[model samples]
Target: MPGGRLSRPDRQRIAALLADGLGYSEIARELGRPTSTISREVARNGGPGDYQADRAHRATEQRARRTKTSQLPTATTVVEPGYGRNPQAAQDFQEQLAALMVQTGMPRMAARVLSCLFTTDAGSLTSADLVERLRVSPASISNAIGYLEGLELIHREPDPGRRREKYVIYDDVWLRTWQVSARQNAMWADTAELGVEVFGAETPAGVRLEEMRQFIGRLSEDMAGGPTEAAINDALTVTAALIHAGRPRSTAELATALDWPDERVTRALRDADYTPDLIDPIALRRTESGAYAIDVRPERLSDVQRAALRDS
Candidate 1:
């Protein structure tokens, strides 16, 4: 299990269980562990953590790693190994990766599922595979996969010869994710314009709301005007090369960076995507160095668009 990171207290209990003469298989059955885990645990900690549950648990984990190292062959092999085949290594890696992903703002179960998926060579897994991989229920796998799909981090594909569907990580996952973000921004701009209608443009409340709306709207337009992703990427490559070469930017300097004109660059910055305030288009202004930067995150409402709500 992905979700099973034995806490300090849990490890302490396991140590006590082992001392009671419970066999490794029995302890695993009682603790819902794979038998290998119980055997490894007792072998790792030099038998106990001074009887303190927390201290003993940490000691056990540290010992496990040392013990594992001793077991490896001195010579490296061509095929390293599937993590799952090495019970402790797989368990520790999955748990560690899951914890890191959660710290980065992913939900716990979702992170665990993602960790397992990434670890596999397939770049995909059926729901049953997820359930087995994470030791989670079918429903839990379904829910996590749904959230991953919503984020465009994963998508479902048919499993040939099998009735069930497999969730897959797309080859162009990052590009597809970026497109989803852009589409969302465009939607927000549309809502902002509607807000101006709901609150009459002349009213104080309406003015404030409209200002917010216009800022987002303009940002959306600016994003739309920016060079297509391929062009932008080429520009980034040239920019990086310029930095490495220690060269200054000139009009002709950037012309070779991308085929786009200076005017297009100017308009792209004014794009609502670049300036949330819509208060000052000047913020979108280019520098003499030909670099463009924005002071704020482009407006895409955090809350559901208020304009979507119909009047009673």
Candidate 2:
């Protein structure tokens, strides 16, 4: 019965997911069917672009009726509901969430996984649970989990009692996405600024590039935690101390280096939302040697370290 004819809701989900930019393979995985099933259905229903849920369902009913004379009865099985979500409503919501995630640049499988976790009451799922619920392969679940983790949408929590780990979405997950998006904006701004110099700032191409640089730089500043003039001025005394320290320092380091109370230095970065210790827009970078450096080139950092600077 698992691979039996798809229901009307299933067709609706397929149509929705197609609109969300999911490929056939991803749809099949989500619906617990073979890839060819979706491929054939889509092709027969006017291809991906024109496929409509209501039309597809009507076509399927017509086809079944046409073959009714030759049909034979098949055995059936009874199963109880595993969750409270109404089948049709749940599938519809999943499709919509998947579409939104796709628009935000998440791959279909990863979107499916994150949406599943987000909707659950616990906001968590083990890899095995994902494979079973999505009716996908273990490898597919693994890959999707990894991708979501990379996006900071989910994290792995060790469950020693069950001897399995669960992937979880935190309350601040949306904020983390903003952090990653801001860093990406910064990267683009840097490239656009470089383009302005290459094409001459007065040239048409350079002018366009300059506009891009300016817009993105402003976005990056907001992402980097913009503080008011009054806020910056208030923290100026402590912030100035870090500048002439002659070396890179974290909160603890700065406190020790300047013989100031640890909490005072810690509070400056938190309250002022300024650089050198936190979101260094134009100041320091972590070097290959694992030290925060003002002059040294940036190193390819781990996801954890990159998150500290702003998400990767």
Candidate 3:
């Protein structure tokens, strides 16, 4: 029954569950069917508010009769020779993965297209191939392809010796997608910073904007793979060692003090130089003796302030 079409009794139970205010997952649990199946059934039969068991059953029967002769064969199953894999199980897993993607704010059609491309042995599919496999209209495939392409999740390549094009998912698709998200987060942070300036920082709206700017800015930095917590902690520890010594110390000396390897100490020092915001108002300086020392001078001070201090 898990993989079979819903029976008339199942539809009646779905209707009853809906009338009882049970959600799709709850109804699916009661019927021992996949949640996607329950959701699709309700969606195709006037939705939860208007769904009727008899009408839904009739519609399903009519659709089956109409599409029986035209239904395309499914070829998305993974078949590894001698692997003892069940093709139906593989296909069901693909569908469940696509459903999970849909729940994560992805468009349903786009999720299906992506899942199909991912599961295929070639990791590529032409428009016609997608249409045949998905049994959907060409327009729907076209729209889904455009959405995926816009997000950098897929790319197009000309089919060799053919006029049609193929959509491809590469091993680096997730990397590219992550870079896109990092860029978008940076843009959001920039916009929020601008809002802070326009609304005046003391105002409530500006306060909210500033919070957004800080949170998104940090998120963008992390996504960009800048300065891990371990690196930051190491840098802080090195800085503390320098302060405790009250004098410039060589990398070897700092390493010995902290019980760290010289390479680790050197890497920590480099990270400290790269991300100075964590220990602002204090500077890490290389003394003429070729040793590391802490400078209390705020290097971020304005030129005028620096000149004033120099004059003083």
Candidate 4:
């Protein structure tokens, strides 16, 4: 889909497509490419939203200049055609894509496994499929998938009428990924605020960390309650509606609705602190399969339950 030495015309078209908001799959289909090719190209270049033909071209030139400076003889020996119609070409593409993925923050083997999936026809790939396709050991594929799943870049979906599960990448992958980063930043920012009190900002280390705290704190405030709780709540309520319309609710959903903040959400969940979860009773409902589902199932607390909450 995305690899090969794209012609100047092709680069222009790709940039146009990106600017028009075409998804990777749509662009790939139009170009008669595997989506992985497109994904790797965009990721390695500058990513979809930030991609510019001239900028990517200049970056590529800069990288080439660096490669020349290294002047390693093996560089010429290893440089292969961008797109391959043969097994060797496919392997070469995978390896190159793997290296590029590492630059994008993924580990080497995880990148290899992920790139291999892009070359396949089925959107979903099983553990066994990965092992066979990439010619890696079962254990290696398992481990790579585990890490990728942990990053929330991939998800495990149950096989219909089958026992096995397949890893899937959805259209909303990057959107959700960005949300994860934002939540993490918010948590660390909150921790930094706490640090200011424990370690006075007058000291060097404390001051440096406190500065980071202020920076993150400002970002958090802009995102959530800093400037306006009304805006944050409005945005969150819409997201909640979207979730409730589709998937089942878990502890995560309860925390988000209660506005517990990300840190308190994780801490309260781990410590069995019911404060966050108790905000929305309907959020705690269980479906027939014993899985939690979101609905308008409010609980009427008795005199004793009310007293317990009051005491806590």
Candidate 5:
């Protein structure tokens, strides 16, 4: 029973336990189910305060019937090649991920759409494909796509020689999302600072606002416009190659050593120079021969230490 679907009686018992002031874990223990299962069930069914056993049971039944009917033998209901995956397991995983996303403040339809795209092998889907696979209205898919695009989590691209556009999740989706978050943080910090000015500096509200501004300002400063993971990795690789060479190397030589193009090597070298903190103590410098070399800066030492080294 713990691994099976919740029955109508189970819903009744859960409602009773909730009315008795029992927590999710307590109800789960009583029902021999996982706490997450109990929590998710209650959350989706009008929560504990308004949960009704009969209504929740009916809703679950309707959803199941709709899903079953939509998945009947039809052209759109055919399963894709699984490449050895169990269809039921994949479906369960997708549902679980969508539930988690919903818990994190995403709308239910939007979360479902995002999860469906993520689970697809090609990482892109047209509106028609989404509608067919999700068994939802085209308008629902359109709204979800707009929401995801606003958050920079997905983007639209024109389908090759087709009237329909596809929603694509690129490899750098999270990077763009992080940048959007950083911009939002900066805006919050600015607004908080303005609030501090609106209220008197010595007032209680001003103190709170000032503190918020300082905290978010520091976060924005750290997050805004930072080097991407790809750039950082390239810089480190180039630095290691130069260090191992034990001498200044031309861009062409470095490119050949790393099996990269000369332009790519140049870009890596430039990023290393700009973000020296990624490779502290060791610095990149250009020699008179127009080659790059690793140089250790002695400026990190105290004046007395530098004088002592010079005397030695």
Candidate 6:
């Protein structure tokens, strides 16, 4: 039921309606637009809580220039009005997209440029193409492209036919985004686990920190696609210590103690780099015979344990 693109006046009306506490469906009905369109628009522009008519209108204008850039009448070609019926609808869509990206923590100009690349059917754009389409200064385009490249969201490539550089979107872009998230989750889990130890395991703060550790740890594992080499190394360190406690541990025991999957421990043990010195022999004793599958060299046998390692 969406008609021509929303004008600046239309955005102002939407904002006024939003301030009056109307829902998206009610607003859409008032504006004569499909509910979905209104929903998306509101959601992208800071949702119902923060929608601003002027900001949304400006972002819409920015989007319009980018899409309509292709039709900007080259020497051999004439500009064609093919973006949308109202020319303003295309802009509204672009502003919404850019706003959504910004909501996910991308810089505004960078998000706008990325939105342009994402919406284009060809999946590529050049410096000239962007500058022409967005009607912005070349410096703005350059800075946005640089920001996007730094974040691994886009790449610069040679346009062999034109001898100019172009930005290209990777087909597996979301995979790269997930990888970054996985790394952040891993960091968060590690920091939270450390907090649990510092705050005392019995304290409420420690208990809350442990919950955070568990949540982010699981997210790290799930987003990783598989067990990473670093994860394997850390697991090996824990397994080694448990085995050196003078008893053989079942796969289930290791999994339960470390809060990891049984299969992961098994895999880490098979490929664990035992060369790394994790435990100090001066402060700890070797495991009793037959405790470990691998022949860990028994050294500096002692009954005394460090305060840090002692239980109870």
Q: Top TM-score: which candidate number?
A: 6
Query: Where does candidate 3 stray beyond 4 Å?
Result: 1-85, 227-312
Q: Tell me the TM-score of model 4.
A: 0.42
lDDT of 5 by residue, 75-175 (tens): 36545643124554465566667777776667888987888888888888899998977778999999999999988899889999899899998678667
TM-scores of all models?
0.43, 0.51, 0.56, 0.42, 0.57, 0.59
Model 5 lDDT vs. the true structure? 0.80
Alpha-carbon RMSD to native, per candidate: 17.3, 14.7, 12.6, 17.8, 12.1, 11.3
Rank by lDDT, highest first. Answer: 5, 3, 2, 6, 4, 1
- Candidate 2 similarity to native, TM-score: 0.51
**Which scores greater on TM-score, model 1 or model 5?**
5
**Per-residue alpha-carbon lDDT of candidate 4 for residues 45-138, written as tens digits (9 for 90 to 100):** 5456556777667755765685576577665434323224454446556656666667667766787777776655555778887786656798
Error of 2 at 84 (Å): 3.7
| Per-residue C-alpha lDDT of model 6 across residues 114-140, encoded as one tens digit per residue | 877876767788988878766688999
Q: How many collisions per candidate?
A: 7, 0, 0, 4, 0, 1
User: Which segments of model 6 are wrong by more than 4 Å?
Assistant: 1-10, 16-23, 29-34, 40-51, 54-96, 161-164, 228-237, 247-312
Per-residue CA lDDT of candidate 1, range 1-312, in tens?
A: 334656776676787786786777887777787877655554433332223466547655765686667668894433323465565666567656666666556777887787777777777889988786566799998888888888878888899999989988777765664666667776775576456567666768767766776666555545555546654444444434344545444445455555667655323332423432342321332233434333323354333453454332
Tens-digit lDDT track for model 2 on 188-230? 9778867876787778998898778767866776896765565
The model with the greater lDDT, 2 or 4, is 2
